[model samples]
Target: MAAAHRARHWSFGGVVLVVTAALVAAVLISFSGSVAPRADAAVAAQTWSDEFDGVAGHAPDGAKWTLETGGSGFGNHELQYYTNSTSNAALDGQGHLVITARKNTDAGLGCWYGQCQYTSARLNTARTFTQAYGRFEARIKIPRGQGIWPAFWMLGNDLGTVGWPNSGEIDIMENIGREPNTVHGTVHGPGYSGAGGLGAAYSLPGGRAFADDFHVFAIDWSPNSIVWSVDGTTYKTLTPADTGGKKWVFDHPFFIILNLAVGGDWPGSPDGSTAFPQTMTVDYVRASSSGSAPVARPIRGIGGMCVDVAGASSADRTPIQLHNCTGNAAQQWTVGNDGTVRAFGKCLDVAGGSTADGAIVQLYTCNGTNAQKWTYTAAHDFTNVGANKCLDAKGNSSADGTRLQTWRCTGAAGQKWTLG
Candidate 1:
């Protein structure tokens, strides 16, 4: 699990100290090859695209989704009552699902505290659309003002068997009215669970509120990695290295969830400035996979530079530099069904398992560890084999003298790595 907090409280030093401590603590948490005989003629590689022509609507086309309602409060001290009713959720003629939050005066619709005062809806696709690896996205306009919490997220359908963080939750978009234009995306799993889970905020370029208009929020889920983007601009990414001691919760199928809640622990209660009963409009939600297939064959003797390596002994850190891939056991990797990469019997962990540059890479045994997971991008950079840092070169150098490193990536050429 990974998390980020609003920087409203701590001073710069205080924040740095806390992050440093977290990195130090991460250092202490020490945490597959296959070839297939192709039966069919090779097909053209699928070009990436975001077309939602076949997506299901409110009723959720198939078993891909289920409605969740009437829980004893979803960790937040919310006022609205949750119900599994189509009346609360429906598709508008404009090709969108409208989940409305309304004041409910009916005494029959009661809450655990007493008579219900409000009603809302939560929809998920755990059964019907559970996917292992794919691109997931939703175009939505959030509700504004204090106390409103609307989210577009994913939860492992294995909750009944695996339980909570172990099952994993990927929050693609979450906005509390108080925060307005700032939308948050995050991943939740064991080890890095709760308030400190893996996540980040993407404020509108000029710092505008998301409630103002519909925006596309998405995550590209590949074997062992996840990348977050807003309107096509990459903001953050998470790989196996970010999972810490937790299992690689993202490897299985996850269903979608969309809900609007009123007030909670994180967003707090509505203040005098808050408006009543705001609304969240969702244009559509889409999921796409890399089309089920075996790993591509490695080009013999054609080495690609390592660019980044994690999990080496501290003494070997400097020498564990990037070199051309020689199809060696060290270079060959297998992305597991559970979205993790396995190689050399260890994980491709990030240095200090951090998202910052100059972080060292160290290897450790896998225990669903986040540090070992990674996301490979079309841009060729390998993000956290566990969480969100991207592979980077020290100071943008292609020179042999330049050190290889991981850094807060800007998608620069020097940070890109390729495999053939």
Candidate 2:
């Protein structure tokens, strides 16, 4: 059945909130380290990877991930008791990490609420691997049943200190068995956590269930944007503008997690129609970065000097000059998605709002004004939206003290700039 998944909320006493949200907020907190490979700034590279190839019926590599074991509803009143047993999670020797969920009729101390009806495993790269900006991907075939939930997600690296709703959460792939044809990708932060999270879903075409085959789920995360895709088809792209003026708090590192949950507020409970011993098979998991592009970093020019703000000031009309690249905030510029060059939260502007030839360029508080917008061309010309002129180095001088001004687009060497 093809349908849409809506965020659900629950009420207890006088408080109306989502059970799953409370579970995540009240529980799930950690911080650790891993010897993960670092990504380069230019060109894409595989930073961290796991093939899940090991002896049959054995646990996954201890150097990559560790099991997160518990049964306390996992913050969502889940019926599964998570254990470190190999029966619940292991490598199949055939190049796959297999997570199996079974009906736990065996009594004992396994259950979180009353008798445990199911058992599963949760694996996390908390202290083993974490990254800031990169592409996170995994290929897997999920289980199908009434109450099975399989997810590959991430939490901010500061989770152990700041806690949920503050640490941020990114759901790269989440599939409830009830919606076998659809998988969701969501991000949760301050004002947009829990039932208020912002996200989108991708469903298989032709009414096909995702459980019928292995599919690639991935997210390409950059400075303030994230793009989601399934099987190489991008379905959603989110940015700070999507948030309702809330803080963009995902500008830090995060860790990975993979788990098979049984019976949660979203998927409900396994009933008579459900089968036993369902499994989610993961062929591999990898994280990569297209390296750091110039747009996200400070821009440099001739003489190896950085585009600087005069005196490192935040005042309007501060001269935008070329200075020794110190890698300071004053010299750090961001080519915003809005087409403005920003430094210290201010936009690069033309002094006195002039359009005349030789008008000096300066830094001003960003106000979305035309003077603040610039369009960079492949030829390395910075065209000001307000003056409709090109940013040029006076007299074609590459000297450090040469002043910067607006001039006609002459395609001259002086007007050309290169991002470093």
Can you write out model 2's per-residue Cα lDDT over 134-196, one digit (the tens) per residue? Answer: 679999999998888898988776665566767788888988888879989888888887777
Best-performing candidate as measured by lDDT? 2
On residues 1-420, what C-alpha lDDT tens digit does candidate 1 reach at each position? 112442111112211222222111100000113222122213323322222233234443333334566634565556677676655666655566777777775678766567766788776654444555666778888888887778888776566555666778788888878777688888878776567678788889787778888899987665445767898765665667566655777766666677887766677767788765567877877765433322322211112345333332222232234545444434444443334444433344565556666776554444455665666555556677544776566666654334455677788766665543
TM-scores for the candidates: 0.63, 0.66
Off by over 4 Å in 1: 1-64, 291-420
TM-score of 1: 0.63
lDDT of 2 at 385: 84
Candidate 2 regions exceeding 4 Å error are 1-42, 293-420
Superposition error at 62 for model 1 (Å): 6.8
